[model samples]
Target chain A: MTFLNRFAGLRLYAVLFVIFIYGPVLLLPLFSLDTGLYPTFPLKGLTLQHYAEMAANTSMIEALKNSLTVAVIVSALSTTVSIPAALALSRYRLPGAAAVLGFMSLPLLIPSIVIAVALLIILLKFLGVALSLWTVGAGHVLICIPFCMSVLMSRLEGFDPSLEEASRDLGCTGWQTFWRLTLPLAMPGVISSLLMGFVVSFDEFVIAFFLSGTQTTLPIFLFSQLRFPDKLPGVLALGSLILAGSAVLVVLAELLRRRGAKSANPGDI
Target chain B: MAGYGLLSPALLIMVAMLALPIAALVLLSFWRQSGYTLDTTLTGANYARIFGLSDSPTVWMGIPFYLAYPVPVILLIKSLMMSLTATVTVIPLAYPMAYFIAFRVRSGKSIWILLLTIPFWTSYLLRVFAWKIMLGYTGAINSGLMALGIIHHPLDALLYNSGAVTVVLAHSWVSFAVLPIYVSLEKIDRSLLEAASDLGDTRWQRFRRITLPLSMPGVIAAALMVFIPTVGDYVTPTLIGGSGGSMVGNLIQDLFMKRNNAPMGAAVAIVMMAVIALIALLFVWLTGYHKMRARRR
Candidate 1:
């Protein structure tokens, strides 16, 4: 009887904890649809005015374009860089490999704001590079590379190197073997890394705030809009859109990760 | 050899993109610059100012009103304290959730994980703003309390304070803490727990002797994941910290954007890097030591 009581108690606690975790996020869409300006209860009827206003806003469109452009470029570039790094770390017997991996992961440890400030000073003063979309893209690439490496490294670890060796022994060039055999096997990792990179760059605020000039990203534009209390509803509407988009991307990434893990672990079948 | 060739682009990009910027930050800290003039002339003035070591050489010295300022050091220490407090609070709450998901629950694990991660999809700024609504005067909690005749007036003490910032940030980062600890907990073998129970061990004894020690790696990882980012965060403090909860990152932001003193900003940035690096190294060392001890026993 006591065991059954304790089991019921545990289930109740779990349900409440999950509610606490997701309660506010689910409230965002509710408040966005709310006619009331403030997020208080006692529903003041539903309205689509905020969503319509968001569509008519030109600056929001431009910022969305900028964010999309940066996210795409950063995702492609970071993936290209990480593939080789992940391949080398996983397959090669290089000296100081652990240290190299550790060094690559340092950006994850340091704060993004510090990196942004440091790069802002260094790039402008020393490199004579003007701040633009290119600079913001570069910062995103740095932040995304570690994530790319980890995802790709995990995928590569479970791969059997003998396949590549067999291809090499059969008169296939290294490049050919990599492009044909290895790349196909690692495709899922590549896809996940690309999606993860895009979502992170799209949602990143600190680096874009410091490095962007004339071409502000979506998050920065939303932040500026938040200062006017009257614009809160429209802001909430836009935030809901971003939330939906990110949820889709996260789901896609998880799907790709699972596919990659399943392929790597054939015993699961 | 071709794998090395494939690796060169990434390694080179990392060196140029990451290492160079950090090196420049450290180098710029020692140089004196004024207005638009950035020069290579090195001095200890920046560090002295940060540490409050420089003495004024004015002839009209010995004024009782003059005292060295310790704002930088004080902010750095305070930020560390705040981040540590957040980390400490997050762990106990996270461990239970992670344990429940991994060991106790068998059904709907994916849905639970998905629900846990849903909060991260929203704009981080908007989520923080939501707290302002919930905690503000005449807000949900206060208004609801008054409507129920629980309190006569709205609670003015709920918003724009350290307590508010801590709670909001804790809510924001709960998923981050939970996921890592969940991964580690999931890796624990079931037979080990069963073996403990078979040997006449109490539930608490099994948890302490087996589960906790094995999960230390996840605890350490979660601590670094939470503590490091929280230390350098200025946005939470800026939005919810109001007056009393400003951190070192806020000081860095002020120096860079508001003050327009790039040199001083660089100096503060370098100091922050040093402090954070030291803390990260300490965390890694401690985790390594614990792992070694666990392996021995």
Candidate 2:
């Protein structure tokens, strides 16, 4: 192909590809708005009936509550644990730092299915812990820690050590220095980590599916509802809401992460 | 000691939640299950069943010979094929997009990256369901075609198949491919391209020699990232992939949930992990990832 033809082709491909990624997502709100039960087209006169139905559904509400609970717990637990570890790895000359960092990130590399199965057996067989929201929370913690660590680590690495040194020279204790100076400076990463952890935990499915017994999380509930053709509209409405919520959180997290990175190396910006 | 103390909490959690369970998975695979009770005695039965090397009398009879070559193995192979196909397909699609953002987008590259990742952060279930809706018989594509008088009836071939699964997967996974490749592509010094053009090298030749090699690391990383997760993905296949499109992950899920055979599921899970690990090692070795890192250092 000629260079001009190829350039045009690439642009066309990119546009088509974006459509591929987003077209169906756009359909979600359209179908959710459609008055018909089915997602079929022909402009069935837009109505918010499905969303109203979703609002009235008790089980959907329950599942959303459970999901929110799990996400909050997971985010708090994972971020709290990740911060000190991130601080240690970034601020100290720890032995086996490479291996420790690798260990922290191991969960991200492994498949969710494998982790779910492993956790399932351990909880059910060994610990004798009944499958519940807490099990799901623990699993979320396992997965979210690495992400929290990464975000916090980047933020910590960008921090100016001399600031802490100056605090020490000014007769401040280590705890005071951390609380007064370091923690405030690292606040962006901390917030970003919490948001990232929450989003990850909220969107997670397989682990919750495996670990949850009677109390279904939002995703597990959503997956089960897909089997019922009548539930399609409600699920579509739910999906649209989730899409909007996650989009906002992701954008916010990205902005915070970028802000943290910019502060880390102010010269880059 | 202070550093060690700070690291201990995360390490203990990982060991308890991650390392110990993986160890238990291996041990569980060795334990025998008889009816409702799981006997604590170690046995090679689960492994044999997974590999189709079981020593049951039915093996001698060759009746139900299909059992000799177990479903998990076939499913694993199918998953391998699906992941490989999806990864290969996604590369070409992602490369051009990444190229556009890195080279063509003169300003607001961060905004483009953020936009791409916004969809990435959306629920995986919703994304898969979106594709399912789009490719359904009476779904968007079919309805649009009908509205245009392109066809009378909705196309049944669009959804509930392996092709649908692959297409949706490639679509959902495009961002993962884009981010890494974009990073690598962005790192390409513009001066090199300008110099090559000044030396009368054609655009294609310049891309072939300089751009391609420079971006290979990111491409490889992206491929690994996509391929590994896709291998164990049950969600996409479940939503779009019908019975024929089921992968090892679906089979493993069934073994645990429906079949109530945790040991066998553990075996299958381990086997899948082994396959992923092997593929990852091969990719790392072929790409000389260590060499690349050392050179950078």
Candidate 3:
């Protein structure tokens, strides 16, 4: 009945919401451990056969390699691009910063499918550019920019601007100040942006699906495997592995960001 | 000058990757594609087919009549409907989670937010694919029921329907929906709620009068956030959506990749984007989110 405590039902809803978000994804790992080919109930005993098979699958390994390469490139490129933009936004009163920021976040609002198709058109039809890992990486970078910018912006904004100014007043050049003070302070966000960008590109399917040629990413390979019932268990194994790896990386990134924020503005994080 | 210098690289990339490419796609939509070569001539024929420029139409709900090639238009409508359904379901379910974390959680709100963010940063493909496993023919739901002697046959209705697509979208996007709403709720001044309570207002009355209106920006943002992206989603509809569940994304994919009709595909993509933009702008105008900032200024 109290204003602060009328959420007895809400507490229960929160628990169920967490379950709803995680329960389906957890099913992949649960079924991966089962011996049954189908992801059904009533376990047919536990087995690690699918993991072994996934390890031995040469095609899947090649796709995983390609995905890793693209993800690495995407993470580096997107983060590198975002650092300056985030710095500019955080430090300066740029003209129309809000509108420019909104414009940049356009990729987040538009469908990845539309991005994919449009890129496919431009690359193949207009630019005469071939569909390769480069195009896929480009798509990933566009999608990753808004996220990476926010991460770096938060980190840069949290720290006192006085530090950078102090470095500047000490006769350090702008680039020197950025290198010696700004970049170091924003390191946590830089790393977080890199990891998140990597996970996004690695698991991205639609953009790569539309933009790729002979080269395929792990997700594209997994999607292709979905057609065969025999590959179901292995697909589940791969999916579960991706899910787990992403969770670990994201949690680590979030913790690092929080730690950076806590140190920058003690007590808020 | 320094700010612009620093920002130019990111702005350039967006122009190269987004603006230029989309413009090309838009131009290509006007040009005809016959075989491998694109005819340099611009034409409205592509747009014409979508809006029933020729032939008698199959009318639905006494509106959205299409006489020729109604597939793209129909799928666009279907995808929008499914996305709205998902958005509606998510707001109600997510509002309470957001509300709980905002109003109830005292010390560890960051932990709860982190929990929500973790799923969001994970593979969207894997999350949706997981739903396919749970909702498939011999999926967990049916298998569990059969195991418990509750059913003689696996239920086919659980998957391969618009309902399946809607449910998956709701689950996958609930995390994103929660954080914004949570932030908005957390930002509310406690004094206002206290003010209401002191006036002998009920908790529900306080929420309805103060909390709901204050959080409208987040709710509207959350709705557009989920609805816009999911409307053009390709993976969910294709992987599990059977015939009945295919959205505009699937149709676009088919036109370009399978059918090799890139111009037609471009037209469909443009149409989908236009409709989404209209709806988004209208929603913001209706809710006055866009004007609220300027009004405050």
Candidate 4:
């Protein structure tokens, strides 16, 4: 009944929970290093051949380039557009803001597969738009916006609005007030929004899978590669690297957000 | 008006990409497809086939049944069943972690949350694919067992079934379940617990009365998060859930990609959305969650 033993059980459960989440993920690097192709547990001599093989693969490299290109553009585009809307939602007394937010967040509720199919129908059947990297990039932007908006919205809402009001009162034009006061204040959110958008667009698979015609994003490529058993090792090597990359990006974003939160309002964090 | 102006760019993008595309999907569903050329005729035949119009026995034995085109209905039920199982599993597992963070963790609260969710932001494809490596015939589990001299043959039964799909799904949504429940648990007033204890409420009693009810919103939110996504998930099932494990997602993919039936795929997609929304609403109603939210607002 005491505090110590009561939480001791919970602590143990927490440890097990971490293993459950990370266990499968960690298997990637472990197997990627294994000389054997299968991800079986028995220790095989370590090898870097898969990574080498991955480096040599032209299609894999192309997919990586395509994914990176899409992610960068998507991050910038989603964040840039989200700044105004996010600010509007957080700061303004706009009518139907809830409905706007609801509509944006609808993609989160509906299955990504369903969304992909919907977009596919639009591009191919209605618009007569040939499926290409352009369509994939468009899909990425759609999925990234809701996520980026939420990140920026939280950051915008987190700080004092009095500063913006004061700037406006001091005869600063609306645009000047936003540029001079609001944008800098919401810098952390903007950065976080960009990072969020990047991470989402980078790891995105379903939408790209449906929208892409001749070109393949890395995830779509990885998914197609999943069919071949021999392709698994290179897949593992690539998967491990991606997992590490995204993990780093996410941690960096978190650290920046925390630091930014502190700077935004002294002692608030 | 300025606010509207500020919002216009993001709003326009969503409308052009998300809203218009979905509207187009609905419109496409009403049209017929034949050999790469879409027939522009507006017809309800797709819906009819989906609802058993083409089939002679629309009402088999008492309830509406699809004698023909049974795959969508069957897979829809199965997908819902698996998602429900995964959602139910997620709550118990996620609640403890959320609770530990809410009540037990003294410092580094954000770090703990960050640690748990980092995996979520990573490649969902890789994460789902990991299960194939873990549970496949020559995957980690069977091979590990063999190395330990626990079993001789690799268990083919471990991979590619509803069982595999359910487990992967439950694992896949771990972060989504935890964060919301943690927020709800964190928001519980410390004073309420103390007041309940002063009134002779035991720890368990206090939790049952106050903590549980208050946290129901988060729990319900977690359930909806897990249930809704898993129902429409295509990756996990496709990777690990072979023929026996194929859900509505796979069928929709098949219809669109392989079967050359885009209109039918649209129909199935619409139907899936309708069913998912209906079930989610029903659950929220049953839990009185909407009333709770309105009252809170």
Candidate 5:
């Protein structure tokens, strides 16, 4: 009886915590479907008008395109850069490697707001470069490196170095062995890194806020809209779509990560 | 040689993207500039202005102090407090969930983990905005409460306050806290728990002495991970804090964007970084020292 009681209590607490975490996100879809301008309860009737209007907004569409373009470019660039870094760091020993890795990962610790402000001052003042989409892409690459490195490193670590060695011994060049063995083995990590990097760049706000000139990303567009409260229902509708998309991407990323881990070491799980 | 060549791109990118910007921030902090004009002569006036060392103490200290001081500090402190509260709230809840998943639940650990991570998929801003809609004056919570006859008047305090920000941000970040602690709990040797049971230790006694200490590292990491970023965050405060909930990040934002006072902004940003670094270093050092002392004992 006591055990059952305790289990019930535990389940209750867990459900409440889950509600706290996920309740607001769940509320967005409900409110988006709401008929009124204000996000009030007592739904007058369900309507898709807000979503349709959002779809038809030209500037919002442009912002979405800009965000997508930047995210894709940044993800591709960062993954390409992280691959060799991950490979060398995981596969071989080098001088100051720890320090290099630490430096590379330090951006994760520093607040993005600080980085954004710092970059703005530096890029405009010292380099005399005007803010542009390219600068925003550059900032995304900076922030995305640590995530790419960590994911790639985990994949690299689980891989057996002996496979590459065996391939090399079997009359294959180092380059050829890496292409055939390492690259194939690490593809899952590469894919996860690419997905995660894309999502992060797309969703990132502070960096894009500072670096984007004349071109507004979706997040910045959403932020600008928040000042006007009446437009909030429209924002909620837009937010619901973004939330659904991001959730799908995150799940895909996680699956890729698990797949990478599993393939790198078939014995572990 | 190929490996070195392969590594160069990332290194070069980091140098250009990160290191150069940081160097530029330092330079910009030392210069006196108005709008687009760059003064060739360097000065410490910005730092002086921030520190209230100038003759125009109002610009240096009074105005920003009055207008900007309370919001960011309060928001940072409130967020930190809320994170601590959430951490405490989560420990008891997560300890059992982790326990159930690790030792009790017979199958589908990966599914639960996936379920936990689902919330992270949505854009962070969108999630926060969702909370705004849910907690607003005419929002879901009050409507539900009023429908339930919990109160005649709607709870005006439900949104745009420190409490709302704290609750929502804590919800958003709970997964980060839970996952680390779960990993640590799973690592505990089952035999140790069984031995404690065999030795006739009460369940509570066994948990207090065995499970708790073993999981301290994860708890610490979880707390630090959530606490550090929450302290620096401005988004939650800006969205939910209304006029009262601005954080240090907001001040930095105003300095950069609204005010265009680069030096003052840089000074505030530097100070914010220094404060976080100091706190993080202190936490690590204290934890390390405690571990060493416990080892000696």
Candidate 6:
């Protein structure tokens, strides 16, 4: 009780910090609702004209499709590849475990622009691969795997080995034990990883910018459209929808993370 | 062996997708560039161009002078300074918020964290654009000021400068700072603070001696999380940054696309990575990260 009063000033700062963080973004939805062509102040009137225009834009719909496809493939690939690696890192006292972990996390430390440029060069020169959604997915997987591994490692690390032993004693084979026990235990972690990975791939711009071929991601399309003043309202409308969708996804992911934290061991994500 | 087998596919992907490409980037940095094709011959010309150093030695009275730096080198240094400024600005703001959530909220901590992260979940491009809209001459800030009769003319200095880049980047990366700091604050043993208070230490003294030292790891992590990524940020500078606010990343993109110089771009990328790694190492050393890791072990 005394502690709360001692630092009562902090609550004000926290509120201000929240305002500072979200003020610009929250204004986005307000402007989207304004009938004004520009997202400036003194809105003309409330209307859904921008949203209607956004709905009618073929390029916007196509970009959405491309983004979804890239995001789904990247999420699946990242989680699938990370599961075994996370298992090995958590369960075994492997040689060079620290080095392996460090290497896996290198992408997070380096600039995304560098990663994008490096991947672009590698695909173009060494592999003779063309710039496509597949290439973007490849880069996304490279970056997203580390995130997936971090979440899965926490879930896997806390598993009771004795549970597997008990299952085996009950005549369960390796595959059956994994299916019945291990998967269910780690399901929350897996879900969070998938959702977070999807979000990362969906919103990522740099790699998609470089690796995008004829079909571009939503970010790339939005970026190109930013230069045109006339496109501002419609883009804001699209951005508002995306903002709402992302908020839901992030909330779901956080809820899953909390559930995993309660049921499994508490891990600082 | 089975563990090794389990790790192989991941290792393969990392090597193939990440390590090998970086290696190729370094190699390409050295390779000579001709009209439109890169020569197989290895040369140090790209490095020389990136650093504004000349190979020819013309020592006048034992004093050495180099050629003028290319534009990208200047932008790289500017980017480093701007990113540092933004990281420094965000630390003070984020620390208080993280402290509040960790110690004050008590319950519904996750909800606070979720609210903080809501901005990040949305498109980073749009968030930066949002700042652009707010800062533009005819945008929110100017109009609000005019409507309130605070100022007659629109403020021209509100956007398209290094300062605007710093402000937007700091805001965009605040969640990164808050999360790490919150985690570290949570890890601190509450009884330690109580014990400090019980020893007749004032609140400031207890925070300085106990809480601050304990949270150094998170502070350093937060700093790195914000600093490293913002240094090479292309979007913020591109939209709100105008000519004066362009970064190393914007230059690198131009080097590849507009100038048709992949070798130079690769060299710039390599230099940027090396500079970031050096800064990170310095930060880790100053924060006693090695000692912290040892103590944990």
Q: Interface RMSD (C-alpha) of each candidate?
A: 2.1, 1.6, 1.0, 0.8, 1.9, 1.3
- The top-ranked prediction according to DockQ is 4
Per-candidate DockQ values are 0.55, 0.68, 0.85, 0.87, 0.60, 0.72
CA lDDT for candidate 2: 0.87
- Could you give the DockQ of candidate 4? 0.87
Q: Report, to 2 decimal places, the DockQ of model 1.
A: 0.55
In angstroms, give how far residue A155 of model 5 lies from its true place: 2.1
Using lDDT as the yardstick, the better of models 4 and 5 is 4
Model 5 agreement with the true structure over B36-145: per-residue lDDT tens digits: 66575788876565544323222322243333234434434554566566556555555666666665556778877787777764577888877777788877888877
Candidate 6 displacement at residue A207 in angstroms: 0.5
2 or 3: which has the higher DockQ?
Answer: 3
> How big is the positional error of residue A220 in model 1, measured in Å on the Cα after superposition?
0.4
- Pick by DockQ: 4 or 5, better one: 4
RMSD of 5: 3.9
lDDT per residue for candidate 3 within B149-264, as digits (tens), equals 99989988998899899988888887899988987898888999999999999878999999999888789889988988999998888877988888999989999988888999
Model 5 chain A: worst 10 consecutive residues (lDDT sum):
A260-269
Candidate 1 lDDT tens digits, A77-151: 999989988999899998878788888888877887789988898888888899999999999999889888987
Docking quality band of candidate 1, CAPRI definitions: medium
- Model 3 Cα displacement at A178 (Å)? 0.9
lDDT of 4 by residue, B68-104 (tens): 7766887898899999999999999999899999999
Q: Spell out the clash pairs found in candidate 3.
A: B57-B67
Correct interface contacts retained, every candidate: 0.51, 0.71, 0.92, 0.91, 0.60, 0.74
Q: Number of backbone collisions per candidate, in order?
A: 0, 0, 1, 0, 2, 0
Candidates 1 and 6, the one with greater lDDT: 6
Writing each residue's lDDT as its tens digit, candidate 1 over B1-297 gives: 766787888888888888999888888888876776766788877787777643552221232222255667767777887788888888888888888888777887876777676566445766776677677686667866876788888888888777777777787787788888888889888899999999999989999999998787788878878888888886788777877778888888888888776677788888887888788888788669455446745
Chain B alone vs. reference chain B, TM-score for every model: 0.87, 0.92, 0.95, 0.95, 0.82, 0.93
